[model samples]
Target: MKKKLISLILTLIQLSVDFSIVAASISLVIVIILVASTPFTGFAHELFDYHSWWSLVLQAVTASVLVFLAIIMFVGVHSLLRNINSGLYFVNQNLVAVRQILWPSLVVFVLQSLASICFRL
Candidate 1:
């Protein structure tokens, strides 16, 4: 039980650290986009040209979701995959820690899946 708690705490730390790093990188991209929004009036015009505020809002939301998924894929999921493979043969030794990682991953997967579905139609 103590070990499980220890692993849980460690996983929480790892999750926060990883999330902050990924979010920071993606936020930089959004900053770039917002910065360019001023000079690239043409691009911004084209983006909001749909004439529907809802469409612009939806596009912005979609971009954010896509960026989020990319970060999860590059950082979170990739790291989890590496950890899984590394401990696969000895997983019984670290099942609790793996579970700690998986709960958030499943949530991330579901959210990303929901985001992608909106783009289908």
Candidate 2:
């Protein structure tokens, strides 16, 4: 029963990850389109005001990068979950995969926080 329950939970997680992949892809595409059309149209100016055009461009680019990272992270999670569901949870590759999922995001978080602080200053 415990195994079945775990499998069910993993299945739910898989579904959630799949949904996130779709959502992230859509967000990336939208951000790219907005950035691309920024100079051609008045959309960015209207949205961010004329004085903050550079900030708007920076934000849009940053959002696109984050969304791309999220998609990669989701794919990595799906791969890890697939292995775990198949009873390979304790293997060396899984350990490496877990670290791969964790450490980079931690670094990104730290860097992003520092960048925000510097920008504020």
Clashes of 1: 0
Q: Model 2, residue 25: what's the lDDT? A: 98
Q: Taking the tens digit of each residue's C-alpha lDDT, what string does model 1 give over 1-119?
A: 98577667667766776777677677858745744463445564464434444545565555555555455444644455445544453654355555555665676677668756754
What are the per-model C-alpha RMSD values against the true structure? Answer: 9.5, 2.5
In candidate 2, which residue ranges exceed 4 Å CA deviation? 45-51, 118-121
lDDT of 2 by residue, 1-121 (tens): 9999999999899999999989999989998998888777887667543446676677667667777777877877888898899999788877776776776577568757865874575
**Candidate 1 local accuracy as lDDT?**
0.57
Per-prediction TM-score, please?
Answer: 0.39, 0.80
Q: In model 2, what is the error at residue 99, expressed in angstroms? A: 3.4
Model 2 quality (TM-score)? 0.80
Cα error, residue 58 of model 2, in Å, equals 1.5
What Cα-based lDDT does every candidate model obtain? 0.57, 0.78
> Of the candidates shown, which would achieve the greatest lDDT relative to the real structure?
2
Q: What is the lDDT of candidate 2?
A: 0.78
